[model samples]
Target: MEITILKSVIIDDCTTHRTVLKRLIENHPDLVLEGSYRNGIEAKNNGCEKNADLIFLDVEMPFIDGFDLLESFKKRPQVIMVSGKPDHALRAFEYDVTDYLLKPVSPKRFDMAIKKVQRNTGTMTGQSEDEHIFVRSNFRKVRVDYGDIKWVEALGDYVKLITEKKNILVLTSMKAFEQKLPENRFLRIHKSYIINLDRIENFTSTEVQVCGKQMPLSRKRKSRLLDALGAG
Candidate 1:
């Protein structure tokens, strides 16, 4: 499938960071950097649709941070939080960003995250469907049916997978899981939580009840979840 350019914005306080990010966006076949801002105030004052398709944002900035700017937007966009430190990753996930890109971002890592977004973009329009994910378990590789996943939670460098009757913890980044799982079926409700939509029994703006457990629901992901349910 041909990936289309999505309306995008970049917000960072560092000039070098902006330059690096701009290059990455320009290199991507499916991303268009709409504007670059030094801080949240500039982005907020521009008077454009706060509902951008994607946002490459810095975690710490003068005047207002990325998190504050995200709150100001009436309709939050798909956010990819950019940070220079690993400590803020948990906070980034609390906002349920699309992906977290560490400083000095690698082209490979950036491309991987973009692919996940592209897949979701396609699924939103009924263009494709992915049925399973391959994982390394017990010193061997195995395929896990997408439907079998109940919920996934981050555990440091790995993620705990809860399936129909099994709980498996794999040593992998949550971003890997995000990329492997189909977005239409799996939604990231919080930094630590990703749940299968079919298995969801109840959910509020702040939490999703799945497998009889309540997972956090952040403002960043709530709109997307509602839209997914509506589309389904």
Candidate 2:
């Protein structure tokens, strides 16, 4: 199999930070540094993000902030946010960002983030994830078909997978469980719930119905859900 080289870009206000990021990206075998811009406007104007697969974006900028830059994206790409403070990590995760890194990023941490990007991009190759995935249920491994799954709900440190015939509780975090499912078919619609897009019966701005059960939808994720549904 041919390795997919991810074309990458860096948008940091500090020249030193941008340079450091460029070096790190260049050192990676699976990544290609397409452009390194000093700011969001610079990146946009230079057309650096076209056909780019990844972005290393600084959270704090003068004019267009990191989240604002994310909002302006023509198409969502894997974003690894760089920030000086940890205050934005939770919100950045809400955006479904690949990873958040503090300034003066270590080589080990950079590689870890790259691994996450690889995982995300690799799962997105096919049109659908109509395959079965196994889960640990009741001290035994059980296979669950993708079509059979309706939704997943968080329970403290664990997640419950709701399927047509039965529910299986797995010892995993929502974020970890979400990564196991294909992004095209399953999405984290709320902080506590991930729903199979194919199983959605109806959805308003506030909630979605799956398998005859209504689940709360985060207002922040409503637009993303609509986009996933290809709603016009």
Clashes of each: 1, 0
Per-residue lDDT value at 29 in model 2: 82
Candidate 2, overall lDDT? 0.80
Pairs with steric clashes in candidate 2: none
Total residue pair clashes for candidate 2: 0
Off by more than 4 A, model 1: 48-51, 123-232
Q: What does the lDDT read for residue 212 in candidate 2?
A: 78
Worst 10 residues of 1 by lDDT: 120-129
lDDT by residue (105-126, candidate 2, tens digit) is 8887687567657655763233
Best by lDDT: 2
Give TM-scores for every candidate, taking all chains together and pairing residue i with residue i: 0.58, 0.58
Worst 10 residues of 2 by lDDT: 121-130
